[model samples]
Target: MGSLIFFTVSASAPMTVLAGGVVTTYAVTGSIGVPLSFPILGVALALFTVGYAAMTRYVENAGAFYAYIALGLSRAWGVAGSAVAIVAYNTIQIGLYGLFGWAFSGFAAAHWQADLPWWACALGVWAIVGLLGLFNVDLSAKVLGFFLIAEIIAVLLFDIGGFGHPAGGSVSTESLAPGSLFTSGVGGVFAFGIAAFVGFESAAVYSGEVKDPRRTVARATYVAVAITSVLYAVSAWALASASGKDGLAAGPADPFGMIGQWFGTGLSTAANVLFLTSVFAALLSFHMVVSRYTFAAGQEGVLPRFTAATWRRTGSPVAGSLLQSLAGVVTFAIFAMLGRDPLLELFTWLSYVAAVGVLVLMIGTSVSVLGYFARRDSVESVWQRIIAPGLAAIALIAITATVVVNADSILGAEKGSVLTYVLPGIVAAAVVIGLLWGYTIKLTRPSVYAGIGEGGARQAAALAGIEDLLAQDERIPA
Candidate 1:
C-alpha cells in the first residue's frame, strides 16, 4: 500500500508536468545548469526530509502537516499547515485538469482531425476519475501503474535518442558551469526545480493505508526522492546535451521537438503519445493527493466529518473524492463557458497559481522541520535539525520572493498584473483562515485539538486511559 501510494505520489502526474512543460521552462530559465539544479534542490529537500522522516517515527498521522506541526509547535500551526496543503493540492489538481483537457484535444485534432473542445475532454476525464475515486484505490493504482510504465518507457527512449544522436553537433560543459546556473539567478531555477519534486513527500499521506507505518513511510520517502532525483538529473542532462550549447541558448519553441528530430519521426510520435499518457498519469496522481488531503482535513475536524468517512472496503475517501471531482467539473465548465482555451488560457493561468501555493507550503514545511528538531536531545546532527532547514527556508523564501517579483515572466502572463498578486494573496488568506480555525478549536474543543499529532488509535487510547477504560476500542478491530 505504501509503495502504491508512493508510486501515485511521485511517478504519475509529476512525469507529465515536468516533462511536457516544466522541463522546457527549466532549460530556458537555468540553461545547461538545469540538470545540476535538480540534484542540488534534491539535496536541500533531503535535508528537510531527514527530520521530517524522523518525526514520522514518533508521531503517526495521515495528516502530514498536522503531525509535524502538532509535534513541533501547536495545534494552531498544524491547522495552518493543513490549510496550506489543501490549497496547494487543490490548485495543482485543478490546474492539471486544464492541461489534460488541452493535451487530449490537441492529440485528437492532430491524429483524428477532430475539433472537439478541450473542456469536453477535461469533463470526460473528470467524470471517469470521480467515478473511480468512489470505488477502489487498487483500481486507481492499477491505472496509474499502467500510465507510469508507458511514461517511463517514453522518457527512456527520448533519453537514449538524445545521447545516441547528438543534436547541434556536440555537448558543451558551459551549460553545466556555475556561472550559467547562477547567471539566470538562483531564484528561478530553485522555483522550477522545486516544482519537479512536488509529490516526493506525499508518501507519508498514506500512513493509514500502508502495512508498516514506521518503516514503510521512511523507506518510501528516501527511495522516492532518490529515484526521482536521479531520473530528473539524468533526463535533464540528456536534454541539455542533446540540445547542445547553442540550441540550449537559442530556446527552441519545442525542446521535445528537437529531441524528436534527432530520434526520427517515429520516436517523435511516440513521445507525443507518451506526453498525453504522462498528463493522464499526472491527473490521476493529483486527484489522489487532493482527495487524501481533503480526507485528512475532514478527519481532523477542520472540515465536515463526512469528508473523513472512507469506503469501508476500498479505504478511499468517497465524499472527499466526489467533492474534488465536483470542483474540477465546475472549473471545467467555467473555463469552457468563458470560451477559454484549456491549455493556453486556463491551464497556463492556474498552474502558476498552484505553483505559488506549493512554494508557500514547502517553505512552511521546511520551517516546521527546523522547529520540530531544534531542541532535540537525540543523536541527530545539527545540520539536519538547524542548518539544512534554515538554508532550505532561506532558499525557498528567496525563490518565492523572486516568483512574486517576476510573476509575469514566471507565469507567462500576457496582460493584467491582478493574477500575479491575486494568486499569492489567496494562499496567504488560506493560511490566515487555517490559523484562526485552529485557535477557535483550541478554545472550544481542547481535547480533540490536543490530540492532533498522535495517531488515531493512540489518541483514542489516550482518551480511553483518561477515562480509566479498557483498551479494546483502542485497537483497530480485527
Candidate 2:
C-alpha cells in the first residue's frame, strides 16, 4: 500500500506542482483562491471513492476504470473507456518529457555551463524510464519511493520558508477564503487544480499486482488524496502568503526564483534538482499506468494479443512497456522537429487534455458503480450502491462542464480557437473509434468480445503460449 501511494503521488510530482503548477495556475487564472481548489477536489473524490472502492472487492484488473465500466454498463463502453484512457495516460506521460527536458536543460546551463537542448535531455530520461518499466513493479516502486520522499522534504522546507517570511511580515489567509473560489475564474482553478491530482486514481491500476487489493486500493487511494490535498492546499497558501495578494499577478515566471529569495541560493539549487527528479518520477509512474492499461486491453482482446506478453520472473508487461516507449520516442521527435515550446505548448496542452480525459473517466466510473450494484444481489449498503456514486456523478458532471467552458483560459488560446476543440477532440475521436471497434468485435468475434474486460482468465491460453515463446528465447523462469 505504501509503495502504491508512492507510485501514484510521485506521478502527481509535488515539486513540479509547487514550482510549476500552483504558481502558473495563479498567474494564468489570476485567482488568489488556488489554495481552496485542492480540498474541494478532495471532497468530490472522496465521495467518488465510496462506490469505487466497493467495486474493487469484486472486480480486480490492471485497467481499473475500463474493467468497472465494461462490467457495470456495457462492454462497448468499457472498450471506449480503454481507448480514452490510453490516449489520456499517454499524453500525460509523454508530456512530462517536455517539462523534464526544459528543467534539466536550465539546470545544466546554470550550474555546469553545459548547454543541452530540451529534447536531448528528455530522450535521456526517456531511455532510463523505459528501461525501468520492464523490471518488476516493486523495483519501480522503490525508485518512486526514494524520489517521493526527497520531494516531500523539499516541499515542506519551501513551505516553511514561505510562511516564515511573509510578503508583508504577516501571514494572510485571503487565498483560503471559500468565497474567493466563486469568481469568474473558478473554472480555470478547478481545471488546473484537478491536474495536480492526476495520479490519485491510479491506486486501482495496480490492483492485480498488490498483495491485498481490497484494502490496499481503498486505503491507499483515500490516504493519497488526503495527503495530496493538505500538501497542495498548505503549500499553495504559503506561496500566496509569501507573494501577497498584490504580488501574485507579478510573481516570477520561474517559481524557484521566488523560493531563492525566501530560502537562499543553496536550498533553491537543491529544490531545482529535486524538481527534475520529481518530473522523472512522474514520467515513470504514468508510464507504468499506460503500459498496464495497454496490458489489460490486450488481456481483454481490445488490442493485439502480443500486448499481453509479460516477463515471467518480473511479471512486467513486456510488450506494453515497449509499445509505450515507442509512442514516447515518436511524440518527442515530432515536438522537437516542429520546434514547439516544451512547457507552454507540450506540457500545458497535453496535461490539460489528460485532466479532462481523467475527469470523463471518473464520471463514467461513478455512474458505472451505481449501475453495477443495481444489477446484482450484494451486501453493500444503499448509500454505497446508489446515493454516494449518484451524487458523485452529479458533482463530476458540473466540474467537467466548468472545465470545458473555460477551456480557452486553461489552454491559453483565444476564445473559440480551434486548438481548444482539437485538443479535447482527441479524446472524443478515441471514444468514437473505440465504440466502433468494440461493436465490430461483438458482431464478428463474439468469443473474443465476450471477454472484453475479464482480464487474464479468458486469455490463459494466449499467455501460456507467450510464456512458452519467452522461455524458449531466453530460458525465462517457468
Q: Which candidate ranks first by lDDT, i.e. highest?
A: 2
Give the whole-model CA lDDT for all candidates, comma-separated. Answer: 0.67, 0.82
Q: Write the per-residue lDDT of candidate 1 for residues 154-197, one digit (tens) a residue.
A: 67776676677666666555656777666534544555566567
- As a TM-score, model 1 comes out at 0.82
TM-score of each: 0.82, 0.90
The sequence of per-residue lDDT tens digits that candidate 2 reaches over residues 307-393 is 988988789998999999999999888999999888767877787888888888899899999889999999888988999899999
Model 1 lDDT-worst window of ten: 469-478
Q: Listing every candidate in turn, what is its Cα RMSD in Å to the true structure after a full C-alpha superposition?
A: 4.6, 4.8
- Choose the strongest candidate by TM-score: 2
